[model samples]
Target: MHTKASVQSVADTARGIVLATVEIAARPEHVFRALTEPDQVVRWWGSDEAYRMTNWEMDIGVGGHWRSEGRNADGTSFRASGKLRRVDRPTALSMSWMSDWDGGQASVVHYALEGTTRTTRLTLCHEELVDRPDACRAYAEGWRLVLGWLQQYLAPQSTEAFFLLRLNPPRPNFSEDMSSEEVALMKLHFGYWATLLQAGTAIAYGPVADPGGTWGVAIVRAAEMDAAWVLTDQDPVIRSGRGFRYEIFAMPQLMRGE
Candidate 1:
């Protein structure tokens, strides 16, 4: 099972844009496919439980057009159409979006994806809403919900158990005086864990800022203790001969809620 997806929203009133970001447990190519492929879009585009996509068509290219039609639970129908402005496969896409609900009001939507082969960070920007602040907010929420559905749809199925990973370093004092090479390695270390977090292999990870010493912690999902060991042993810091080690504990009963 995967952890609850995290959605970050930023509304720039001056620019008339709503920005949303979420990390998905899949690669950029997979996420791009889900965004542009008609079948995948139908699966995760709507928020209402009873909402179902009735139609999906798209010509995926620079000047391609796309449209979708769906009905709400109450039998009310809605439609959306858009022209592809730009399409950079597996990385970015921009389109002009128009819907029937807003009296033909249109906006530009951009999706940007970045990450490694096992995880992706997706950023969505809905702009050109100069006179449609309400719609901007609504789209922000709607995108968040849709992304949640996407995450759930793409989450890796696992019958594995969970483990608590405690990271112990040689020393916990990280100050500005640290060597630049070590600092760079630490950044790589953080990046490594971030990929795991987005991949659902790690449920959560962070450094505990204790006054005595700062230690890292993570909750990992794995089939067994050896799998957990493999993950921790691959940490860049540990590989750098920095004397960082991990202690793994089996979590028999874990409770998580969103």
Candidate 2:
């Protein structure tokens, strides 16, 4: 299950860059259709609690124009439009994005897809908002939620399994006193798992208080153990080049009750 992730992309709020990535159990061609095709875009573009994209217009080409208009949950109206900057069917698309809710200015939105018929990795990058940090932060959550909508629309039959992640720090008292760099890395690690938790990739994760020593533990869901390894490998602690390690185990049987 430890095959590499489709894309190695993360969001940088300071840079006004937001990234939302997901691996769908479908071909890129099919996902691309759902993304660019006008008829299908209306099917999965928004949320029921918020605003649903009720109208869509698309000119499918580089330098083409696309627009979407919808009403907010409170019945207020909103609209967004963009000019296509690049188009690579089933692979990528880039455009100049501007929406009423997005600072009413031109930013950039790029979508990259990589995969086969079994599973496809999709990544969305919303960039060029250096002047609007709030928008950047909001888009971080918005894009992830939007991706969740797209995944549900695809109706995938993922090979999901429960994984137990035993996180080991360098020393016994590492948690009590971490270095400055370690603290910063912990922030990134928290954000990483927080994103996953919101996206439904993680069930629960936090520091563990052990009698002998304190460590960390994360229970996540992935297609397989290799994929679980991929998830752990991306953690800030594991990638910090420090001596942080994770022992992964599979939960063969997970019983849930009310």
Highest lDDT model number? 2
Give each model's whole-structure lDDT. 0.79, 0.80
Model 2 agreement with the true structure over 85-194: per-residue lDDT tens digits: 99999799999989997658889999999997557789899999886777888877778777776775554234677878888889999988998989999999999999
Best by TM-score: 1
Model 1 ranges with Cα > 4 A deviation: 47-50, 156-258
lDDT of 1 by residue, 95-195 (tens): 99999877788899999999886778899999998767788777777777777767655553355878888887776675334689878988999999999
Clashing pairs in 1: none
- Can you list the residue pairs that collide in candidate 2? 1-226, 1-227, 2-226
Report RMSD for candidate 1.
Answer: 16.1
TM-score of 1: 0.59
Error of 1 at 67 (Å): 0.6
Query: Model 1, poorest ten-residue lDDT window?
Result: 150-159
